[model samples]
Target: DDMTDPVADSARSLLDGHVVLSRKLAELGHYPAVDPLASVSRLMNSVVSKEHLLASQRFKAIYATYQGAEDMINIGALAPGANRRIDRAVSLIDRVNEFLLQPIGQRCEFQQTVKWLLDITKSWDFLLPAEQDLPPEVPAGPNEADA
Candidate 1:
C-alpha cells in the first residue's frame, strides 16, 4: 500500500509488492519467509500493466488454491482433484520451501522468480510426479553452491 516509503520494512512498502509468502517458512527455517497472505500489493491495478497484473493474479490464485487444500487437510477432507492437484501443490510448495525464500539480506533474482512462478502455475494435465520429485529440505542456494 505504501510502496514509496523507503523506510518501511514490509513488502507492501516495496515498489512491486504482490503476495506475502508465509511466516511458516521461517518457523521451518526458511530465511525471509514472507507471508503470501500478507504480501498483497495495493498498486497492482493502477500502476502495473495488464499482462503483468494478470500473471500475478494467476500466481496468487494457485497459492490460494494450495492454501485452501492445506485448510482441507486440517478438516480431514480433500479437494476434488485428489492427489493430482495435491501433488502439484506439493511441488509448488516444495519449490517455495526449497528455492524461493532467500537468505537474510539476499534477494531472489528476476528470472529465478519467473521460472519458479511458471513452473508452479502450470495447469495439471497429468498426475503430479511422485513426492520424490520434491525436495525434503531447502535446495542448495548460491552460498551452498560454492561449498
Candidate 2:
C-alpha cells in the first residue's frame, strides 16, 4: 500500500504543535484562576475555530488525492494502492473526529482527555510507516482485495 508521506508529515507536525501548545498553556496556568471553565472554553473555542480549519484542510488534501486516484482509474491509468492510503487517511480523520466530540469542562476528565490527545499527537510519527511506494498509474478497475 502506498501512503502519501507529505500528508502524514503535515498531520504529525500539526499534532505536535497542538501538544506543545497545550503543555505550554498548562505550565503557564493560562486557564484563569478565577474561572477554569472559562479558560477551557476559550481554549476549546480556539481549537474548534483555528485548529479545526487546519485539520480540515489536511483531510481535504488527502481526500483529494484519493479522489484523484479514482479519477485516474476511471480514465484507464494504472494507479495502484490508492485504496490503502485512503483507508489510512480515513482512520486518521476518524480519530480527529472522535477527539473533537469530547466534552469541554474544567474537570480532571477533560484535562486528561486533552493530555491524551496530546500524547496521541506526539506519537503520530510512530503510528505511520516510513515508506510507501506508489504506482505510476491506476489499475484497470477497483481491486476487490481493497474491499
Candidate 3:
C-alpha cells in the first residue's frame, strides 16, 4: 500500500501535473474575448474540488500498474499483452515529455498532442484488475429477480 512505482508514478505525475495542467492553461489563452481572471478562477476551483481530487487518486492508481500490488491486475498472468500496452502508454508519455521540452509558445499540433494524452488515459482503464473491469450493474434483465 505504501510502496511506490517510480516509472509509472513519475509518468502519471508528469501527465497530470505538467501535460494536463499546461493544456488547460493554454486553452484559456486561445480566446482573448473570455475574461482571463474568471477563467483562471474557475480552473483553479475545479482543480481543488473533491471530485477532481478523487479522480486524480483513481488515475494514479490506474497508472500504478506495478507487479505485486494487491489491488492491481496480475501482470504476470497477462505479461505479453500488459507489456505491450504499457509500452504504448510510456511511448505516448515520452512524446508528451518531448513536446513539453520545446520553447514556450512554439508548440504546434494541439489536436494530435491532446489525442495522445486522451489515448494514454483511456488505455489505462483496460489494464485495471478484472473485478474493476466489469460493466456497471443494470436493473433491466430477463426477470426482476435477475436484476
Candidate 4:
C-alpha cells in the first residue's frame, strides 16, 4: 500500500473536519438563547458544504477502487451497500443547509443531523478488515521450502 495515497489522506482530512464542525455545532446547543442559523450558515460555507462536495467525489473514487476483484471487494462484503451510507450522510448534511435557509419554526433535527455527520467517518472504518478477517498464510511448496 502506498503510504502517501491522496485518497486516503483526503478521507482522513474529511474525518477530522467532521469532528471540528460537529464540535462547533454541539457548542451552540449549550447557549440556548443564541440563534443557530448564522452559526450554521457560516459552518456550511466554511467547512460542511465544501466537505459535502468532496465526499461525493471521494465516494465515487472509493467505489471504483473497491467494487471489483476479490481482495478489493471486502468493503462491499463487510458493509454491503456501503456506498449508500455515504449518500445518506451527504443527504443529512444537505438537510442541515436546507434547514438553515428556511424561516424559524420549520421543524428539523439540526443537532441530531450534525451529530450524524460523524457517521460518514465511522462508516469508512468498517471498510477496513479486522484482524480476524485477514486470510490465513498459505503453506510453502516443497521446492520453495528447500530454498
Question: Which stretches of candidate 1 lie above 4 Å from their native place?
Answer: 1-23, 46-49, 74-87, 105-107, 124-147
Runs off by more than 4 Å, candidate 4: 1-45, 49-107, 123-137
Compute each candidate's TM-score over C-alphas. Answer: 0.50, 0.28, 0.27, 0.25
> Model 3 reaches what TM-score against the true structure?
0.27
**Per-model CA lDDT versus the true structure:** 0.60, 0.43, 0.41, 0.41
Comparing 1 and 2 on lDDT, the stronger one: 1
Q: Write candidate 2's Cα lDDT for 1-147 as tens digits.
A: 112478755765555232213343345554321221111122444566454434334544444444445456567664345445554544464454444342346354755664545543432332244344333464556675576
Estimate, for each residue in 61-80, the C-alpha lDDT of model 1 and write its tens digit: 55665786787766878644
Q: Rank the candidates by lDDT, best first.
A: 1, 2, 4, 3
Q: Specify the highest-lDDT model's number.
A: 1
Instruction: After superposing candidate 3 on the true structure, give the runs of residues whose Cα lies further than 4 Å from its correct spot.
Output: 1-85, 105-116, 130-147
Q: Which of the two candidates, 2 or 3, achieves a greater lDDT against the reference?
A: 2
Candidate 2 ranges beyond 4 A from true positions: 1-80, 83-85, 103-111, 126-147
TM-score winner, 1 or 2: 1
The better candidate by lDDT, 1 or 4, is 1
